[model samples]
Target: MLNKVYFSALLFLSLTLNAQTSPCKAAHIGKFQVDSGESGITVIERNKKTQTEINEKMGYKARYDIVWIDDCHYELRNRTVIKGKSWEGSSPTDILKAEILKVVNGKVFLRLGSNFSDEVMECEMIKIKS
Candidate 1:
């Protein structure tokens, strides 16, 4: 009877821990920072249907309309360049694909690519706020 009780307790504890570690879609709705190497850091804020990115060092800010294909994948359609005259060439029709490759602790590994180009960029974004 003692062995049975101990086994049940262990099973319950394992299940409880697994539940706690499960990922939620809403967890990614927050502010994050991406180190853009020579370009400096880019701060990104994600919401349900939109995402805003600001590169303070470059004096650039842009907003994108997000179309979530799935929990892990999404497309960003450039809506407008809120600041920076250099970004005026950005087309509203430009589409960028982004995927959340993995989330560990407070960092999210992302893969980004452009629909009009073959180039792909991968970076780790540190969560700044949730």
Candidate 2:
């Protein structure tokens, strides 16, 4: 029984430490490719991003904007550009707002809540070393 309890405690502590100091944190700050089913795959970069690079084979174009509301939270534009300008303060649509801007298990995901659809969706992004 003591051995079981010790193992469990050690496992929990290890997981907590890893989660807090994840090397995958790089995935949150650079360019990444994400597979969006019919869209196949798309490239997302820091700040300025073009959604049309989804995939020629898939014949699907993506449209989105990731506006960093803060370091850890983000808001997306329902429209292509933010208030017809790329500036942060410009009036952007809140229809695609997302939060939880952290990385986990070598991937960064944006939780889509009531923006693109009524259901909650998670879009994962891989890190680009460049």
Candidate 3:
């Protein structure tokens, strides 16, 4: 009886670890769109080969250099100012980080900004193309 109980405990532990280690995949490298609840939609383009990302919304576009911390997390350094919008009063070198919280059925849930901060934003990204 003791041996059977030990075996069951080990099996449960292994399954839990397996679930926690499921990382994001390379197939997420592509463009995505989310409705902004306004007249325009927000577009995000990620290029894993180039290690870059472009975000466009409300006629403004910003580019970032991506540094992958792991398969599920990455840091984004704002490398360029919004081309179609004026940035005369703001710093051009802003930074942000993002993590893949979950991926289900080709849709990725992303959390943006520092995890310690209370202002983190969550967005769902659907792959549009490779």
Pick the lDDT winner. Answer: 1
lDDT digits (tens) for residues 43-98 of candidate 2: 65554432222444544444565565655565556545422234354333645556
TM-score of each: 0.77, 0.51, 0.66
| For model 2, the run of ten residues with the poorest summed lDDT | 82-91
lDDT for every model?
A: 0.84, 0.57, 0.68
Candidate 3 clashes: the total is: 0
Candidate 3, residue 4: how far the Cα is off, in Å: 19
- Decreasing lDDT order of the candidates: 1, 3, 2
Q: List, in order, the clash count of every candidate structure.
A: 0, 0, 0
For model 3, how does the per-residue alpha-carbon lDDT over 1-130 read when each residue is reduced to its tens digit? 9999999999999999877755486434777766656636666777863233333544567676777888888876655645565346545455567889987777788988853345888988777766
Q: After superposing candidate 3 on the true structure, give the runs of residues whose Cα lies further than 4 Å from its correct spot.
A: 1-23, 26-28, 49-57, 86-90, 114-118
Residue 127 of model 2, lDDT score: 65
Candidate 3 accuracy as TM-score: 0.66
- Candidate 3 lDDT at 71 equals 82
